[model samples]
Target: MENSIGIHISQSALFNWLIIFFISIFGIRDVLPQETTIKTDSHAVVSVKASLLPKGLLGPIDISPAVIPHDQYPIEPQSPMYPSFPSTYDPILTGRCQLNFSNMASIIDKTASDCSAPLASLVGNVICCPQVNSLVHILQGTYGKNSGSLVLQQAAAEDCFSDIMSILASRGANDTIPGICSIDSAPLTGGSCPVQDVETFEKTVNTSLLLDSCSTVDPLKECCRPICQPAIMEAAVRLSQRESSPLDNAKIPGKSVGVDVLSDCKGIVYSWLSQKLSLDDANAAFRMLSSCKVNKVCPLQFKDPSTVIKDCRDPPSANSSCCNSLDIYISDVQKQMLITNRQAINCAMFFGSLLQKGGVVTNVYDLCNIDLKDFSLQAYRQQGCLLRSLPADVLYDNYTGYSFTCDLSDNIGAPWPSSSSLSSLSLCAPEMSLPALPVSQNSRASGGSRGLGLALTLVLSSLSYTQRAIP
Candidate 1:
């Protein structure tokens, strides 16, 4: 029984050892598959995370088998990448938007409100921006730097940007303030005045004067009234820009040229006046042409003969002796016409009055029947009437055509000689003889008496002639 018991125990121990070996083999197989799965999943998760990163952050570390081949996956050109670069951009927000004053102001106000900054700050920023800076330069070139500066200052000082916008909206895009600023300079701000501007101003003044009728009577006063002050100011500014001394002082460059310019202008004005008024009137008008002052500079003022005489209070007087001589000559002509029984006495009177009033005559019948005061007899002798030659029919159709000569002479100072006789007679001595009449009450009526009286009165009035009478 002891032997049998020993045998069973040994078999049981062998079976237990075999079962343990099989369990160990199955456990090793299961652990090997789990380890392989876990390793593969972790590698896949790492590759996906690396692919999700930005190209800038990811260096040259591609792990794909297809990408590892140098010939197939060659390096490609790439754009520069910066981590701090902005994600988005807006032109208006950056003050780079192109717009006019009104639109710019509106946009600026909107930007300021959105950014929580003041209107002044927004305007300052906008004006200083690159885009706006270009616009400012353009404005400066067109309207002048002084005007640009003023606009800049005004914009910066405004409490409400929208207010300026409204004002800009009301004006045209190209409209500018008149007389406040000119091209190349604005005199109010001590800016440089261009030579072209001065020339243009002078031309404008001259054109205006030439068109005015009153300029003939008082050229300096009438022409300079509108342009004098502005012209003077501009001249001063121009001189200052050249760093030149005063106009009177001779140290300034181009001083003589400037003086000549002013003198030429004065000459033109006075010359025109001389052609229109009598000598006495011209003298008086020139005396009244004093230079105007602007910014302490008097460019138009000069020491010339007329000004010197006026300053000395020795204005020239009209020639009273010449006037007396002309009066005597007129009386002689009238007596001769009366003795000759001429019919042209009324025509002579009409022309005589024109010369006495204006010292010149363009037409014979222009001053007929026109009342005149301050008639200068001396002036009448100096400048005679302009008479057009009468038609042959009119001259020869008269009753005295057989005896009267129609050979009208322009020599007003000397007498015209008769074609039939060698005797000479004054121009006022009519060439036509009186008509013969029958003795009757109707023939010597009121109308005939009035006509004779008028003819006689005209012959007795002022009558004189000029050596160079215009025909």
Candidate 2:
């Protein structure tokens, strides 16, 4: 006021100066108000906010420490523990029986009047039906018989037995022998129906069917029936496991092939089918069994290991025709191991492509998804199939930050960690922490205190202030 150079020394300017001086004094007073460094209880604030606020959807979408507590300091009997499976599709402990013709007949008979009726119905429907009709839909989408709309119905039906015979006939198997050709007018058969003029009957049936006369087809179920489901399944398992011959004796230890009855029949069936139907046609039936698409390679016939190295000249290479067989093998193995349908399909599809490289044979386990690993963890614990393994502690904490219903008492006696402990760990771990840190900010703030800690503290303070201000 003493050095005022302007005519602004009036009442308004003096009032403004007084106001500014008082504000400055009050501001400094507020700045240093208490000098009381009260460390904000970040955890308490978070707990309170979490308890009060409504949780969003992404909160509980986790796969670990699947169980959570209902209250702070969970009551002993109130909270329960849960288990987890690494993968939704883990392999079943029980082994499946191989599907055979009789088995197939049984399945068909269970659904229909008899095997013949169902078979005939399906065949007739496939043959007479239009391209995009129900018959074609079921075959294409559900139980496929062959790889086509409907054109291959007749050819596929004939080739089913033909392919088997072709393989057998190629090895000196003919229709003139006793055991080998038991279907040829042989009353000495032990099974349901004795062979009655097997060759003539087969030829007559083929000719009749080919001519589209619909004459009663000869019942060749006897050949498939005598094979036995157990034996067939065993054979299929062995064949699948076999690296060389489909029926190599060396594979069946302590047993010798006295006579190649099945082999001879297989050869004859193969020859007949190969002649009547094209290679594509013969493969159509096989494709149905393996569920492969047409023009797409199908699983190969299982080979025997011992004789393969000695007698076989053309061994399957990585790029050879045998890759499809390997693909099927890998797919089957995955099916045996995985339980989740979608996951199993994914694995089958993935490995189907890799089998051609021969790399899958050595690294099958590695090719599997993390879900499979989860299942393995559960299987090892032998706990009833829920929450196979404890999820990461950090994951559990973050997961419980949202609304959830957990039963911690389930594993009371088990030496498992508490949900709280898991939550703490999850909070500590960067991968499972809540309110993830921004990468850019983290990179820019070098040598600064952890951003998560600062961000969480700031959020809690803002929330606390806002609540106080609201009142």
Candidate 3:
């Protein structure tokens, strides 16, 4: 309660400060009394010279000290003016980056706006971090063009990464983006991966196979089929073995690499890919690759379920308490962030098991009338949209800014996990109320189900998702 009060006070103070700054820069003549005036020292509120001001939408006018001590004022009142980008404002560049930043104005502007300091913490997961990741991947390809090598040397990585942050900050992006996105210059430097250059990476890994597998992604089933992920992992493992002796290499054919080593090598592989593919293709492939990681689990954080357990332990006897307590808990959950429908299912099952473990035997979701969309940040609560699992990304344009597709064709009931336990529950598990299209669509008998019939069924089963723009 105190925290909420503090936040409200902080927001009110911030709004008041912004209003003052706006008034000082562009004098609010209409709001000011016609006969009223004030006298103060330097950097204080002064008068506006309507006649002397630049004419015809000349942009933000500088409040020169010379304009003060005006004798007569215009009798007619004017509307409040506002500030905008200064005429001479330009991003301070390091002049070290080989990539031409001028060519990337649109994306840079998009990233700057999306990842601005005021907005970063609020939308980091859905907006800011995604754009930051995309920008880094795009920069990798662009910088690789002139350097011939996709990955940068350590010194260059330091300089270029600094320059990237400087450019974004000058354009009003969050300076703490590295921390916000958990990124560093390490990826640009290719991490601790032994293979940095293209020639050695090609010689060590099956370049042709890697390229063929990931050049294009089938969005619908890439998460399930996982053609590119394994290929990337295999390539990363082979690349990680560059420093190993021939004997160890022979013993570890297609063996798994350690966690850190595998991640570093994957970054190296992605750099090598940037050196080969166009920027658009690389960015798309990277988004698809990222989707594979986010597809399996729920991103929303869950709190302790003690309150829910106590209130929801009994069924019809405790209906009012159970539903009331559940609605409160779910409201808190929904404040986490927007998530996809597939992720929502996992979240429901996971949370249900938590409740079941805490002595809540009954399915509270059925009693509380919880929907799948209830598991995510619902802007419209009773009728809000939840995102689709795969084929999701932040789309940007001059007009639309950033947006993502959302499933809005009515809410699906949050499936109550049976007493069968969470381990036995799978998306492909039958006897469940949720959709099950089987694990392998291609392995169907006579290849008949591999056609569009089952695919159409899969599409219709999930209903429709629309592009929802966050304000």
Query: What are the lDDT scores of the predictions, listed in order?
Result: 0.28, 0.26, 0.66
Cα TM-score per model: 0.15, 0.16, 0.66
Worst 10 residues of 1 by lDDT: 387-396
Stretches of candidate 1 above 4 Å error?
Answer: 1-261, 264-326, 329-471
Which residue pairs collide in model 1, if any? none
Give the alpha carbon lDDT tens digit for every residue of 45-82 in model 1.
32233334476664676576433433333366322221
lDDT of 1 at 99: 24
Task: List candidate 3 segments past 4 Å from native.
Answer: 1-89, 103-123, 169-175, 244-259, 316-319, 380-383, 391-404, 421-425, 428-471
Could you give me the TM-score of model 1 versus the true structure?
A: 0.15
Among these predictions, the greatest lDDT belongs to 3
> Candidate 1 or 3, higher lDDT?
3
